[model samples]
Target chain A: MANFPENIVPSEMKNFRISIDDFIEAYNKGEAELVDIRVPMETKVWQVNFGLKIPANELPKRLDELPKDKLIAVACPHTDRSNMARVYLAEQGFNVKYLVGGLLGLMERLKGGMAKDINL
Target chain B: MKEISFDDYLKSFDYDERKAMKIKLNEMLKLYEEGKAEIIDIRFKDEYEAWHLGFGKNIPLNELPNRIDELDKNKTIVTVCPHYDRAEIARLFLKLKGFNARYLTDGLLGTVDYLRGDKARDYIAKIKGES
Candidate 1:
């Protein structure tokens, strides 16, 4: 029921998108990993503490850096870039899910008095 | 007027005792990050849908006993609610049922207040003695 960005075309991949709740559950259980595909400037402003940064443009060249042990939740400022990464990663056989609303949604949820990030 | 009893005066003290039963936010976070504990939100489905901590399972307070089996027996459970009251009750029940558990003393609202006041880093630093 989430409103994904209009720019993203739906994919036929098995690993698709994840809810904030699911992301949280997987993260807390240590069964999930986060990959932020936003560029350096955007990520520098703020980013989830536990997420690994792999700029979208560089992901193909750096895909080997992603962990094979856990499910990957790809995120960007919005769903645009992460969705692309999700499709690409899925094609590459990495178990992946795009963060449904991405980092902007996370910031909104945080600002709206949902839960604060686990640690600074 | 109806009598104002000593029990009324002792009520505040009792509340403090309950507060003492709560797990410190930072300590809970550390335990969670280390995979030593699990955070469980005990609010109703709608309330949970509205907002909740990023890391937790939503098992409404009323649905808990039925779903107790879903929780891990070995890990410490941290129960959460809008305020500490419901979570405390859930913690007590879980404890009686033989699960390792604790309540978030001040609950989700307290966490919001802490964030609004910008005390998160300071509190964590203080707890770790980095401040």
Candidate 2:
């Protein structure tokens, strides 16, 4: 693994937070790539439309499979796991960002009526 | 083989960024009730079928990719395993692949509690009696 820039540390991760609305907007506009770090099974139960599935444990070996140049957004059931993956990807020098509220956060936003018309 | 330090083993599993979104348990409950979120039982098929949360959808970790298309991308997803570790690993993988996902912090049984509401305790008691 490579050393991360001081700004990239998750302790300093605030700069990378992306809200559910922004994520959905980007996805809709095809401006960002969504990466789901959950295992395959959970994804089969529910997931974001068009989001890619790549388990965290398998990410290291499968690094080559991802598009190196795209702006990738990572998400998990919560933020912690995805944060770790974000840190790892950042360390590996990939252009990556993580969802701020995770799926739960997104659901919360939707339920709160903040982005009801977004269609997830 | 020589022993490896826990720290070293942990290091081997290290990834680059560490950003995370914070969500409370109460919020998760509301999502479940609204039908926007699905709790997944990420255990082997046999173990999942033998016993699991009433609402948990069984999806073995290994078979996730091929079955990915079956899920509704618009919904929230929570994964559960015997322990939270496997579920966490699964969550990470799905995030990298760009799926909206999360894992039940309480593991499999915890998710049952969240799903069952106040009935969780009674459910556990009944199971204990049956066993």
- Among these predictions, the greatest lDDT belongs to 1
Instruction: Indicate the fraction of true inter-chain contacts that candidate 1 also forms.
Output: 0.00
Candidate 1, A1-120: lDDT as tens digits: 111111222133224678767887787778888899877777788867777998766676787899888999998776645655675576577989888768878667666446654333
TM-score of each: 0.40, 0.43
Q: What's the DockQ for every one of the candidates?
A: 0.01, 0.03
Task: Identify the runs in model 1 with alpha carbons over 4 angstroms from their true place.
Answer: A1-15, A111-120, B1-131
Candidate 1 clash pair list = none
> Evaluated with TM-score, which candidate comes out highest?
2
lDDT of 2 by residue, A1-120 (tens): 121221222244345557777887876666777788877677789866666788876787777877676767888877667766776777677887788878777667665556554543
Tens-place lDDT digits, model 1, residues B1-131: 12222222122223333344469777777787667889898877778888876556898776776787899888989988776545755665565566777888667887667654446665555445687
* Candidate 1 chain A, poorest ten consecutive residues by summed lDDT: A1-10
Native contact fraction per model? 0.00, 0.04
Which residue ranges in model 2 land beyond 4 Å of their true spot? A5-12, A108-120, B1-131
Q: State in Å the error of residue B61, model 2.
A: 34
Candidate 2 chain A least-lDDT 10 residues:
A1-10
